[model samples]
Target chain A: MQAFDIEVTLGRTRVLHGVDFTAKPGQVTAIVGPNGSGKTTLLRATTGEIPFTGRVLLNGEDVARQKPWQLAAIRGVQPQSTTIAFPFTVVEIVRLGLTAGLSAANTDLPVRALEKVDLTGFENRMYQDLSGGEQQRVQLARVLTQIWQPMVDGTPRWLILDEPVASLDIGHQFTVMDLTRDFATRGGGVVAVMHDLNLTAMFADRVVLMQDGRIAAQGTPSEVLTDATLTQTYGCPIPVNTTPPVGMPFLLPQARMTREPC
Target chain B: MSLAVDAPSVHAPPMDRRVQARRLTVALSLLLAVTSVFSLAWGASGTSLWAAMADLAAGRELSRLDRIVLFDIRLPRLCLGILVGASLAASGAVMQGLFRNPLADPGLIGVSAGAGLAAITAIVLGAMLPPAIRELTGNYLVPISAFFGGWGSTLVLYRVATRHGQTSVATMLLAGIALGALAGALSGILVYMADDSQLRDLTFWGMGSLAGATWAKVMAATPIILAALAVTPFLARGLNGLALGEAAAGHIGISVQLIKNTSILAVAAATGAAVAVSGGIGFIGIVVPHLLRLATGPDHHSLLPNAALLGATLLLAADMIARVIIAPAELPIGIVTAVLGAPVFLWILLKRRGALGL
Candidate 1:
């Protein structure tokens, strides 16, 4: 799906200017920006959840023109914060995801979604009582449950994660990203809006840096996660370098406020 | 019949046993129907099962007393009970959902006080007119003035609740209390100025009744009741989402403002119609939904229907008991409900003890 220059004007305030992008199948497209940088707005506009100008094309059809249910059928999202007041079980909550775009005949979704996030046993437990990371995983389960149903000939589905791991602990953050990475690996399109630059550098197939409601940079991790963009984005001094500690992608921060010798 | 069994099981199988909004629907329907029939039979005439059956079945030429008792008194009164119970329950459920406070009532927005004040006005003013209209006073002045008063109070509540297209629950609650107090203050002024005879009439009217029920009144009320009932069930999915929180509901394809607006209109219509009929029958609206929660769970699909049915059950039985406790001398149904309800509530409070730490 390509967001063909979406324009959004809420009343008088233009939250998103004419923004253009392409989110392709079989790739991790990372949208990273500071707060109010139109990351969330862009996602919302792309999904047609909010009224916005410009067109979103899914399989070469205008996504905005499709019915809400039609659009929902092809896509699923996990927002920044999901507060569930009712004490529905994890499986119960996740089962709702399957309801958006599928027939009841496909009954394997609940178990598959739980298996995707490694939350199988936690199904019957109260959703609200789970830890933040566990709850985030449960939400991921819902998103997966909604989007990932086996097709007639055995195929995967598309997923969009809007800060899916924002509320999770560091370890669970990796688990979520790894899950998204696996999703992309299994021939699925995954768009992850994230703030963890290190995780983005490690897992992102392509990184798109957004600034002030516009794309500031877009390229592979090495090209986009340069010292200059990092400093500018964080409004602080930081060093961006590489290390071979078990070949993990590493960019350690040397200082908080001091600018690097560019 | 199969639809009831299959629909609930599909959404919620016994193996899963989670939330079944439809199960709640059927259960509430059953409760509402049975209790509504029972309410139709209870009155000063002690409408026997055989008699009510005979009355309906044989098209018996009902005795003049039975006609008066059925058509004029019990039937209208029964219709009013069902209407009032349904409305109050609907409004209260929506209020609880809108405010995200489980304990909130429709009258939290001051509609009751408004209706109460208007009833007082009708009573006080009827005396000034000749005794000619006194015969038609309950049949006339009461409902009209109550509807107007109920609408007036809710208009104020609506204005107070809406701010920047966002209704704050705390603000709405405060506005209701303040508006209610104002109505109460105005009511006190009327009470203070009343003569002894006016005072007696005002006090009794304030106690509330379905004794003055009429088919015309129920016919007038049925539309609003039907309207509330019809629109409310459709909102079950959205209300379930809304119960999560505003942001979450929005994320789940629900327009927050639309739901909030519908809630406002629903509360106004249901509470207005209810108060117009039975004056201010308090506490039932507050407690019925909670009691339903235990039996059917918290899903609005079930909660709402169960609330509607149990609300009927409670008011009907209370009204019936009011007729029988002092045989042929009818005490106000409101007095009976409050008197009976308060003890049950107290027992619950004591049994649970610190559970209601709120």
Candidate 2:
């Protein structure tokens, strides 16, 4: 899958300006940047969640032109955050995941997705009763229910995760990351828009940085996470160190406001 | 750092568990069918369930009085009961979803008042109009005018409230309430202008009844009512996604505008058709879906169909009670429903504030 020449404008602000990127089967691409740098906009564009001027090709067809249901068939998405004030059970909430495919036949999609997220055996609990982190897991489980692959082989699935583990504890964070990695190994492609530069460094096979609605930098984690690029994109001095493999890139912010040291 | 934030999990559960929601609908349908038939059989006018059953089994000519009570009166009454109940319930469910509030009801939102006013005007004017117009008065003019009233005000409110594809529920409800009061005032004027006999008929129609139900009216209404029922399933997926709120629903591939607009139209159509047939029944729409949601999950696929069923059943039961309570001298079905529905609804309100435990 590839985002080909995408442009997005939201409420009078040009959020993405002619950004181009690609992710083929069996690889993880991470989008990392500071706040309001357009990373989330880029992910929204790729998923066709927002209107955009560009061609998102899933094996070469334009994504925008596809029927909504048909488009959902190729793309799986976990949005940044969600809220449900109504009372719902874990099982009911999880069932929302299977909505994408009126035809997907995996009866075990919720179970499998929950188990992967380490939320097994909590199926009958009230969602309102769960803690914030647990609710996030159940929402993730809902996605599993929604994006189940009916056929065993040959059809590729693209998972778009927008900071899927930010709310979880350290243990579940790694578990989600590992599951994403396994998804890639199984010939799926994942595009994760995350804030943790360290996690990007550890798991991302390709990295894209956005600033002022354009691709600020794009390459491998080592290529994009350099102190020079970080300072340039963030408009502040940032220090980068080659730490022990923390499974994600580790970037230390040396400055919060000053662009340069005295 | 904003960069440190990870997205909450997007793992949607498998469809099988959700697929089970489909069963809630089927069961609700069966329940509605069972209860509605039972209620229809339980009416007064000295016709017991056994007598009705025996009559059906015998298929013999009824005595003159039995025929008057059964064919001209009871059958029409039963059919109208089903119509009014289903109408109120279906419209209530749609309005609640459209407004995204548990408190929204056709009666409370002023839909019934708007309809009632329009109908009263038609009845008052029937004398000045042609013979055909007078013939349409008693029960007919009321529903037609009420239906118009419901849809007309909705159109005006929708025009004012909707902007660039964003429709706020708060605005719609507030507008509906305000407009409903205005309509009620107009209806009150029509009632004042009504002559002595006209006043009596108007009062009964305003309170709501299935007494005037006839096979002719049922046949006239079946097409639009059935069409609306048939159309609801198409809205199910959109409504389900809508439970996530408008923005999320849009991101998930729903045209939020279309869903909202269609719901407005559907509510108006069903309520209007119902009022044209049964005057104005209150509380059924607000209460039935809330009750059904308690039994079934909140998913629209289940919620809507069950609401339709329970709505029908609840009205049938209310009509039965209306017939039995006063016997030879029947009471309005609306009073029975409100009397029973209010306490149950209040209990629900006191017991649980949000969605039903299910």
Candidate 3:
């Protein structure tokens, strides 16, 4: 998927200013930034949920020219949070994805997707009664059910997620991230807006760091996750460290004790 | 991998209600059959459906009174009741699904009032029309005007309550009240201008009765109501997707705009035709869908058809009570439904107060 010259103006204040973004098949692309940096707006614009100035091309076709069902056959999207209108069971919610995408014939995909999210036994439970994290996972399962196969025919499918693990516990966080990674490994592209830099570094094949609605840096995690760049982008003293054997980058932000207590 | 190993091995099957819903459909069909028989057999007239059937079984021709009462009067009333009841209930389910609120209903949301106003206008001022158009529309002028009025109100209500594809329940309900009041005020003006004979027609029409049912009225409403009903099966999957909200629903391959537009038109058509024929029957739209949701689940695939059958049955029962309660003098069918349905509606409100965030 490719988006170029994307400009989003929300009530006279331009949020994204001529930003260019691209995500290749068979990889996980993570967009990370501080709050109010327009990461979510960029994602929404690219997904055709909002109007923007420039062009978004998915699978070599302009998104504006494609029908929604045509796009859905090749991709699935998971929002930050979903509020269901009615009292739907977990299985029912998951099953919604089956008819929405290319998996209409696969009746068991909902159960399998739930299993992938480690929510195997939650099929019968009321979706509204679940905890926040469980609801998030159930949503993930639903999205997964939409494009159950990583590749259809010779083309790869895509998963566009907004904070896929925002409400999860640490263990389920790993579970979801691993699922995305597995999807990427199987030739499906995954684009996610991530808040945790460490998880992004660990899971993302390419990282795009945003600052004030512009792409501050974009490259491999090691190239873009330097202490200087991290500190400059976030306006904090973030120290970058590396794992001993694997040479993976990590960050630990230190609080400056400059303010006196009241 | 370890998470998989740590998880429980006992795998319960997914709790799907499709089977039970299908059974409920069968059950509701049977209930409608029983109700229709009772509605046809028991009435103010002495002619009995059982006697008529027995006579047919004995290879005897029916008497003139039996033919007139059974075929002409009772049959048309039964058919209108089924058509109007199905239209109201199916319109309710569609509205609730479209607005993503269980409380959304044509009667509650002023579509009925708008239709009623237009119908009232047709009644009070129909004579002023040019003879050409008047002759052209004849019996169809009121229903067609009412359909357009209903369509206009629903479109306006949708615009006011939804923003960025999210519908606010509070805003929708409040806007419905405002729209209903506006239509009622206009209807009052039209009623004041009505002649004495027109005033009597308006009064009984406002109260809602099956007493006006005729072959002509039933035929006039049939095409519109059936056309509306025919569009709903195509809408089932879209409405199911819409339970997840418009944005998510779009992501899941539904043309959200198409669903919204079709739902609005369907609601307007069904409600308009029913209101044009029967005036203002209240609560079936809200009560039927809510009860079905509680019984089977909120899946519109079954909810809609079952709602039609159940609505038909319930309305017929209500019509029977309206016929028999005062002996020779009949009450309005709307009164019976409101008396039976209002408490159930209130109970639903009280039970779902927290969920509805009211």
Query: Per-residue lDDT for A132-181 in model 1, tens only?
Result: 77888887887777667423234434677888878876556666777787
Q: Candidate 1 chain B: worst 10 consecutive residues by lDDT?
A: B349-358
Pick out the ten consecutive residues of candidate 2 chain A with the lowest summed lDDT: A253-262
Q: lDDT scores for all predictions?
A: 0.71, 0.72, 0.91
Q: Pick the candidate with the highest TM-score.
A: 3
For DockQ, candidate 2 versus 3, the one ahead is 3
| Candidate closer to the true structure by lDDT (higher is better), 2 or 3 | 3
Candidate 2, residue B244: lDDT: 64
Of candidate 1 chain A, the 10-residue stretch with the lowest lDDT total is A253-262
TM-score of chain B of each: 0.76, 0.81, 0.95
> Which of the predicted structures, 1 or 2, would earn the higher DockQ when compared with the native?
1
B236-287, model 3: which lDDT tens digit per residue? Answer: 9999999998889999999999999999999999999999999999999999
TM-score of chain A of 2: 0.86
lDDT of model 2 at residue B39?
A: 60
What lDDT score is found at residue B42 in candidate 3? Answer: 89
Question: How do all the candidates rank in terms of DockQ, highest first?
Answer: 3, 1, 2
Report the C-alpha lDDT of model 3 over A41-101, residue by residue, as the tens digit: 9999999888899999988899999888999899899999988888888999999999864
User: Lowest-scoring 10 consecutive residues by lDDT in candidate 3 chain A?
Assistant: A253-262
